[model samples]
Target: MISPVIPEDSRFESDPDEVLGDNHGLPAGWEVVPPDPADRFTVARLTHLLRAHERQGRGWAGSGVDDVLVEVSEHGLRTRENVVVRDPEGEIRAWGSVHDRSVGRMLFVHIVERGLDDDVAARCSDVLVEWAVGQAQAVGAARGLETQQIDTGAFQDDERQHAWLAGAGFERVRTWWQMTRPVTPEEAALAESPDHWEKDGVVFRLVRRSGSGLPDEDDLREVHEVLEGAFVDHFNSSEETFEEFLHRLREDPGHRWDHWWLAELTDGDAPQPVGALIGTVSESSSGPDGSYVSYLGVLEAARGRGVAKGLLATIISDAATRGRDRVGLEVDADSPTGAAGLYTSMGWTTKYVTESWHRDVRVSPA
Candidate 1:
């Protein structure tokens, strides 16, 4: 099958000033190469190459490369790179790229180069930091930079990435724990709620895409509210518009309507869904069995009475029925409710840990 067509806005473009200029005072043989639309074959080759690096336990992977390329090409993003080093043959040895984001007038260093060797990787990382500082300066001059954010989750496994961030003058702002649970025949059987847990005033039901039909505007609005309210106090809590949330998920390679759920209290004259769990199956490198569980939330008022557990159990059963091998989710490491404990009790294991890093950017003087 042909690869999904990514719009022009998502691909990278060559920027002469940023790519050719001195990268934060480092001596350079670097050049920023745009994601040439005509270079589709090269991009695919790079994707496979990056995945190979990931399998060999390299710090970088290809999880979001497609999305990045698409954004650079079709989204009108001003992506820039600092070429810090080059081989004698002029091949790129070390470099980094910076792109803009929707929140917090910030620019993200999406890709950072660590040389092929460990010593070279360290040396290249140091130069990448300087380049990042320069990018911050440039962004501040142009758009009044608020903060510089780089997610090492895409590359670093755990504290290793954190150490690099700290060494680069970044601070750990948050922690995300990736959790996964195997879907077994037992889980499908266990999903049946006990009579005592069942309530006269409320009921739990599974919403299948085929059975219920496509989710309408009302369904999307309700789920949007559920997630907005659920994560209001969590780390990096920000209200995302309905359009933004839908757009982002729709862009995912694994998104499907069947993997979503909505819950409601049955006692009311007109019951509305008060909780939801939206998920997608990923056949990507990190997810082979098509992992699920993208976003799950329960309204504050709907807490207790087995709502959360019931929703989770229902989704797990759904995954099993659909022939999924495992379900995955990322939970805040410091949840006040100890959600990680809940997931653990339900059989999810800590597969890996990730850290979020942030650098406060000084806006250039007007």
Candidate 2:
């Protein structure tokens, strides 16, 4: 292979080895190999290219590639679960990764260069999908699950990737709106009636953490329990263990204990943690600096009593009091819960759209 015409952003000082997919007898200059920590810069460059083509660079933190590499390396994920397609001349044209997202599911991320010929792009995408499926099987084999599903997504406007997913046996599942609420500079000056939106008998509180600065297991479990009950009937909801929920969330760079809150009712004999709201420091994307609602879960017993609104008021008040720009969140586009409408009523708007695709794979646990 010849040396690559490295872009300033993609230049790499290298050290690497191993292949993740079936690379035998590949086209003259094309092959699939496992991702290496050394490939961080190249992957970032490819990510920027893929994202720019999909109009996704607006608020990206420029840390995706490095972050993924760190994730696979630092976590239990194997390098073999991620791959890069290189042209015969040492250029990275595509990258594919599969992350086991608890239960029997894996999240797939694949990026192919649009500048390549259609057939070339197709071939590369096909190889990446194949790799993702193989990784899914490996995940299933390890987890003792008889079957597993691979979940992936593309920008709602990216038809080519959608077609590739369909051809690979994935079905379009649902669309989500990346909604953001802009915090007006003057909103900070407005007095926030902390419990005004709260139900008459309910109280809101933050998840209590230990003096050691770690989240109390009891509190975290309650958060997970509340989320489980709240989203069990939601579209595409999966059965995930509490460990899975906490670990995956902790992986995010902005995760913090203080950002988690609860809606409780204690007027009775005991306090009931009926709803939970998990927020993270947001990377400003077309909005002033703010926080993002990663998960807002209200138990069935707590719905319709203004619990959702109360949880939001808590977040908005906290952000405003702290001088942050706004509080943002995403919602299901076709939710049966009228979630989108609720967000709109509360002043959140659809900023962008994303689509989800899913496919199943059956495997025997080793």
Candidate 3:
């Protein structure tokens, strides 16, 4: 739901003031306004709303204040637009954010305060989705595309969310298994050390960083190339430029250069990049931090060579060595790679399930 900002789309802009100028079908006395992340009150209200939404949908909250703040931050605003719905009494009752994620995909967040009158809540959801559709077209036109896909997600158990998404013309397209594995001190031995490991003619190691702490550009490009090739046949895979890829990953609050890893097949005289794994730290306010696998990909040629398993093991070992409590990742429930089985074998278990909802909107000629 969160990522680094893409470059500003100046050609087809959605003016914030104009966004709220129209009711867009919101009930009388309710107003939609651009959110200011710098405002403590706004951030607090958004955080509270997110926690409320999460609690209602999944019985727990996984996002924090920082996560909310990131949505409306100046840097985030480069490729994102956010609005908060206020009731007659001037309290935020809903929040909607849209990201121009890539050329054909636009990410949307539809959040409405729980416990409101059912009709009012339903109307809020409708308005948010409608706005998202409009934004998708604007983003698509800016990219000179004919169609854009609105991609949003909902918890599998949240019937309310399911109904809202369905009513708004989105169809459930995919299911994901959110899995986690507890890290123990003993698991640190899974790898000889965190720096690098070689076995079966393959070498797995962290993405090289320079003396100034920036990752080597050559290595970064190779990692990107490996992932792009690996996912070419995967479901819903779209081509993202190297700049967009780096910007999005770097924007994560948990981004760590050292958490990035690459695997090379060294069977021949020259080592060839065959796989890449990008990880991030998942911080918890009340417990030890956890490691998260943000992205893991192995070239088709390297599939049977243990490249994916090696990358996963390296992250798990790195987590254990860092004293992290656990490692978390999301896998497509119907993945052709049989990744879920591999994760299960490595002691990971599904903690929750989430579904992706999508709507493809056509951009009208200007």
Candidate 4:
């Protein structure tokens, strides 16, 4: 089915009177506008709105509006145009978007705006939710959509935003603890090279993408397989296809091949990678003032050997060499693997706690 088109003149206004006039107590007249790939300003506005609400009392250090724009416009995942609720004067009071549909059945939506005031925000939220449900229904009717999920998470410190998500019928499903370690000259001096670390005859190696060093097809496939096996049972875990994983990473502005590390077993006649950590350093204006670890994982068979620690040390050392002031990563608070303890032992401390909320969708006969 063709997606609904939102007109240009109605971009970002959600005056209460106009909303009331459209349908009295019920939400109506909301429009979803697809952003032109070249429209940087609209994207900037959406990021600004999200940051304003999401970054409260948290370190906003590594975030950039440009980074978000690049992800939305250049990333391989498909993005619907901005959904906006406007007033008669064409002012946007609320806006959001959905991205990365899978099997044309599951779609994820994130709300970027709600009215600034409590009552108005409530009205705006109701309208936005209605529109979202409608959109999901349309997709399901046309393409056999089965489930729709909306992510309404913000930095850990944003109590108001968290409350709003709960009020909107979403249940907290997970928590990603953002942790950081300050980089000091003394710490650097104390930092030992991970080169001397080995586990069960396995040696660690840092991989850098040269103009000529992109991983061969075999290595790429191995990396994908390793990550899938590593986190298959972790919290909120779900299988992500190789293309989906690659698309998500490529969409990020901070992604770099040099940031990845592999642990290879050298005891045999031929060397083979047994564990890997995929991470990217992101710069933001909030938090510890430098590079953030987007993700890190090790294969199950490779655990208990110093592979995980070696990989982390490699990233930390890399950060120091690059003159980064600090390094950060997120860990599931309830990780079954004791990963959080390992991070704490490495000198990282919890900066804040962010929670996830979920609502299972049930279709009702109309």
lDDT of 4 at 109: 40
Which candidate tops lDDT? 3
Candidate 1 lDDT over 83-106, as tens digits, reads: 324444545454355644334333
Instruction: Tell me how far the alpha carbon of residue 364 in candidate 1 is from the true structure, in angstroms, after superposition.
Output: 3.1
Which wins on lDDT, candidate 1 or candidate 3?
3
What are the Cα lDDT values of the candidates?
A: 0.59, 0.72, 0.86, 0.60
Off by over 4 Å in 1: 1-28, 52-102, 105-160, 190-214, 284-288
Top-down TM-score ranking: 3, 2, 4, 1
**lDDT of each residue in 202-294, candidate 3, tens digit only:** 899988878877788889889889999998898888889888888877778899999999999998889999999999999998999999999
lDDT of 4 at 147: 59
Q: On residues 91-155, what C-alpha lDDT tens digit does candidate 4 reach at each position?
A: 55566554434333333345445336676666666666555555544444433445545444556
* TM-score against truth, every candidate: 0.75, 0.85, 0.96, 0.78
Summing lDDT over every window of 10 consecutive residues in candidate 2, give the lowest-scoring window: 10-19
The lDDT of model 2 is: 0.72
Model 3, residue 114: distance off in Å is: 0.4
TM-score of 2: 0.85
lDDT of 2 at 151: 91
